[model samples]
Target: MSPGLTADDFDFHLPPELIAQHPPARRSDSRLLDAGSPPALIDRGFRDLPGLLRAGDLVVFNDTRVIPARLWGFKAAGEAGAALGGAVEVLVERVRADNRVWAHVRASKSPKPG
Candidate 1:
């Protein structure tokens, strides 16, 4: 990566089929991307995680304990859940006294105000 590399430089287009609209029925069914080795992408399922750990390993889990302020999903236009066009992801930027939130929405277009 260049020192001057901006976010745009890392931009990418993901095929709609590859986007996950919902969580897997089983948490163990999820796949994990192992990037410990650089320059290579190792795809492994959660079942193989036991092999990746050592005895007496101290583990720290992430924010799944609480509901995320962020979400990712494609716009659903019909009953079949077809990709409306690309994906929509948002992150909570801040909260207001009115109990509303300001979020950073990302997609092909900015969403209209309610």
Candidate 2:
């Protein structure tokens, strides 16, 4: 580990072949590891999820789905060159209370607040 990092900086090594490239045959067939007291071993189906939780337990989920917001276009007659136009990336962080968005974008330069 580097001087600035501790155990938290450690990560496991996984080969590409070890990664799950596709969803399981059935969602319920996915793996789960119980790390709490009396650690139990169980293979459960995704459909069995509701039964595992007690009623009224608050659940938080990331409802944000993917968006194809990438834009690739050249600024005509601009000082910036074609190489700058090739640099394109866009990332939407979150939707704000006022319906505006927080985002991270990349190109040849930064963007001003809207």
Candidate 3:
């Protein structure tokens, strides 16, 4: 069996200033990195993507509107309800009909099952 991956496996250094705060003036003008052939990094525009596709290739699209879904709170110790050491960060992935949510949580420790 393969080893499990942790957040550290995907961690890398990226300067905040290098991140794009907004989309390009024209969406199609966005940058695309063509790395299909290794060791050769070709920089292309988003408009060039259609021509690079082959038959039977699958493409997934995300069109959902972005929302403010991040939440922050402290993890409480069981029964006594005392606050834990650090704050817990929750990124809500989805909300169900029952009002429960699916989220990605980050905490100093794993929260006990309630």
Candidate 4:
């Protein structure tokens, strides 16, 4: 790791409108940002990736299968689960061997620990 490097170095302001809510109609139609060389940013298509590679170049592949792990529920306001505090969205990132999970949660109000 480089000395004095911090997580804040990777933080930036990405406007929410720039975020893609849905995938392209075709998988290969996705946009690719070429930042291999600094000070120059090239916009290319996914199909253009093949010609850019040379022999003996290392390629990393993410083969993790996607699953429907997102859950939608409401925060409980009462013990009997009769009242809804607010809507909650949970994206389960990983399941552990100890029957626990790591997730990204979004809600109007943060849930308190039980």
Comparing 2 with 3 on TM-score, the higher-scoring candidate is: 3
- Best candidate, lDDT: 4
The segments of candidate 1 whose C-alpha lies over 4 angstroms from its true place after superposition are 1-9, 54-59, 64-114
Estimate, for each residue in 52-111, the C-alpha lDDT of model 3 and write its tens digit.
899998989998998689999876654565555467899999989999999999988876
Candidate 3 residue pairs that clash = none
The residue-by-residue lDDT of candidate 4 on 8-104, one tens digit each, is 9879998999888999999999989888898898989989999889999898999999978899987777566667777889999998999899999
The number of clashing residue pairs in each candidate reads: 0, 2, 0, 0
Tens digit of lDDT per residue, candidate 1, span 18-67?
A: 88898899999998888767779798998888888889977787864554
lDDT of each model, Cα atoms only?
0.78, 0.62, 0.85, 0.88
Estimate the TM-score for candidate 4. 0.61
Off by over 4 Å in 4: 1-4, 72-114
Residue 106 lDDT in model 2?
A: 78
What C-alpha lDDT does candidate 4 achieve relative to the native structure? Answer: 0.88
Alpha carbon deviation, residue 107, candidate 3 (Å): 8.9
- Residue pairs in clash, model 4: none
- Give, for candidate 3, the lowest lDDT window spanning 10 residues: 76-85
Let me know the TM-score candidate 3 reaches against the reference structure: 0.55
TM-score, prediction 2: 0.48
Give per-residue lDDT, candidate 2, residue 67: 70
Name the 10 consecutive residues with the lowest summed lDDT in model 2.
Answer: 75-84
